[model samples]
Target chain A: MIGVGKVKQYSNVLDKPLSKGKQEVSLSAFAFLFSELVQYNQTQVDNIAELERRLEDAGYSVGARVLELLCHRDKGNRRETRLLGILSFVHSTVWKVLFGKVADSLEKGTEHEDEYMISEKELLVNRFISIPKDMGTFNCGAFVAGIVRGVLDSAGFPAVVTAHFVPIEGQQRPRTTILIKFAEEVLKREARLG
Target chain B: MAPAGPRSGDAIFASAERVNAELFTLTYGAIVRQLLTDLEEVEEVNKQLDQMGYNIGIRLVDEFLAKSNVSRCIDFKETAEVIAKVGFKMFLGVTASVTNWDADGTCCSIVLEDNPLVDFVELPDTCQGLYYCNVLSGVIRGALEMVSMKTEVTWARDMLRGDDAFELQVKLLKQVPEEYPYKDDE
Candidate 1:
């Protein structure tokens, strides 16, 4: 709330300068808050799938916001128009700011050209809560999948995003993978742009 | 290195693992939006938010105790001070001031001039009855209860409601003796 130059009145949020993404809070604070989010949603829904859908919906809005905020602040108002450009942005820029680091790996699907996979050993939410079958894989990743979808969709890339459990040979818990399959129009547009 | 005396709010905040505030702020906003959509009633949303905050407070108090090494034996007055100075700072990266204490020292206000929760937030005309930050009051109440202090916390003012600042009024309702570590030293 520190004023920039002198005492002034801001009639709206738009009037305020966009924060430089410098402010911070302890990781525990966020973890506690996020835990409550999942718990509250759980009470509202009857089954696990419904609960995961609700969590995804919640994350969608956050992803949408982060896209707009980061684009304006960091990219000098230039948005990624190409498929690779946007995916890279989501991988490096969006993931870094939101999760504190780049995602572990972003790989193109060998069988399908229209799909991409983003894998993380332990996503932020996965590290805190223990899921039934695995840690970050099945239940905990829906929200993150939603975030990726939100970013891609709002950026005009309309895609179907899903989360899956990938078992490591020696690891006790399976890591999480986000599978993103782009719509036909998006691929058509990418080909046109190229 | 652990310092000799109790660490200040700034010192603990500097050392703790941190995350981007925008992520936290956006995540909270998303939660509020989801609650409003599901509950429909503003009153119900407030209650749910408070309940969630209470859950967090009960768990967070343990971390607060472990991190902030203040003298254990203190009265309700000092306890409020620590929560304002340390608890808020350690978690939210903000500092609040404890003021306007009653003559008996059973009640006071935690005044926050700048709050991250309210940033970029404006009360829509339809949500006039919503105490958007009820979760904070619930957190204080639940945290105090864990330490054997039954308390009542309410919002006296909110910036979204056009108040100059955010103020939470906390009243010490009862004190049960059960090997409480934060008893007053006399």
Candidate 2:
């Protein structure tokens, strides 16, 4: 319905709808593209950390865009301002929109008030990827971590976000956990909000 | 209701396992942005994107063959139609139109009115020379090559560069003659 009454053609994308997120491509298409992203970055970097950083950086821009788009489209432009509010938004809203479900768990770090973790068993990006033994602890969850960071940073809750694999005693596949530590200013502001 | 016939692209797409378009859209954006930062040259990023697409295309053609059920012996004209109509629709959820053939039946233009790749994308001033959708061309080339049809695909128009539509000029270079079942040599 963009440029509804106007005669202008090639209506601006700003007027274009999000199509209610109904538009889709096959999951394999996304998986193949993502695998290419990983392979392409692997060729560009010398070390695992750098590779993860590159992937994270790629995901950050996505996170930023997701935050902006979802806020405008889903929230009617009202943003999350509190710590728990923003965290819940990321855990439930962002996760659901991007991955088709809420993250498996969101838990606060027992040792620190400012740190939290969002863990997913079989994270979507990691579902089809099996890191070679030689790659040494490289988790594709770094991309998801970057996404959470991007969302938090843009929504005024700056945090240090990193992805780690936490091994379970019985299971062969470890779960990926995104650990987020809020910045001092964010904590201060949250304290005041309370 | 599993009706078996010539399945429309929409039916195949609707039945396939799906994900949010925004996830795909934003992920691609992030890849482009990261490429621009790391490669530091728009041309290199475009080349890399094309190469990545080529790799993906060769692999995806198998899935395409299995799902679309396109006949293997179709002529180049029908191939272009399949690519523009079925191929694009099945993978990208958008249909492209074939146009402007030069009467040889070996070359034509594919015009896309809606491209998911360019959604919410505006080319920055620094990337004026970038073929933002170079990957699409590479995918066409690679996928065609897999079927033994060599092709040259280039951007004729790009909406990101202010063109009204996205167009790819596809030229069929050669079709390798398929010889099978161990030909007996003299």
Candidate 3:
């Protein structure tokens, strides 16, 4: 037996109450941890697509939990029922909780009725990340896209979320446009129900 | 060597940019929960966390140096002070107190009053042997290793495990000699 210690036990962590008071954490710690996450995934993948897929998979789990927690905390435990409502929830409430700011704009796709975009001037996840040239077309924002996908999927609005880098002329930082394309069934259901 | 003047932990915390603690605490909680479910073995989860923290530490040290702008430490005693005062404060927004130095002054313990990672954490009965916060030890070991200081870090006490305070003991093993990786000599 191990010596010189008291045997201590406590109830499960889930049993504890989540506090409503706002608390802050160090951003540098997160950036460094995220940088390491990206680096770790890079070593496991043979191509950029695979790496992005890994990151999305990682973020997917987080998205599912965050959706439940955020709804509980902010919406009086009420889940969003409408398409626009959920999108707005994601763009405003979810973004604010995650990034400390609202997204720049939410726009519908010009050519596609089922497509929408949420644009951010600078993604918090990519603040300190510098993608190397060797890893072509790899954006760490894929993780955020996965989170968006997870939230939408959990809320019964099935959609595909992808992050794209769209540079604006006047903006100092490259803008990230999260393209969300809903499933055909969703559009059909919205049309019939609304 | 005599201990240096006590540094203000609040000063370092006030100057850093902050993120919502929920974003960090919840994300980490999810990761740990996922690991517990996927790995099923508490020991394996601890190992994975340590490995991940090691990877984070090697890269995090560069950021720490750039932001803190502190030079090389004079001795192991000073190293412990910097880590307790600047390292923990800058990263976690909490300052640890350095205490319980060994007679040789090569080992010390850092006592942390608050830990963001374990804000809502509890050690389940099934995870009896698991060290939930082993990542902190790994980060300490990994970061110090990079600076040519081979040190062993272990949890002396954990608040999540019903301890009064979160304490980590760091023992200086030896200083690693510098080596030139790409030297060309016949």
- TM-score winner among the candidates? 1
The alpha-carbon lDDT assigned to residue B75 of candidate 3 equals 89
Query: Distance (Å) between predicted and true CA of B62, model 1?
Result: 0.8
lDDT of 1 by residue, A31-74 (tens): 99989998888788877778888888888898888888888989
Best-fitting candidate, measured by lDDT? Answer: 2
TM-scores for all predictions = 0.92, 0.90, 0.85
Please give me the DockQ of candidate 2 compared with the native complex: 0.50
lDDT of model 2, residue B120: 84
> Chain A TM-scores, one per candidate?
0.91, 0.93, 0.91
In angstroms, how far off is B137's CA in candidate 1?
Answer: 1.1
Candidate 3 regions off by >4 Å? Answer: A1-10, A170-173, B1-6, B29-45, B69-74, B120-129, B159-164, B176-186
- Residue B186's lDDT in candidate 3: 36
lDDT string for model 1 (B93-170, tens) is 988888889999999998874577766677798888898888898899889899889999999877677666788999
CAPRI class of candidate 3: acceptable
Query: Model 2 compared with the native: what TM-score?
Result: 0.90
lDDT tens readout by residue for model 3, B97-157? 8888989999889887667787656677898777788778888888998899998888898
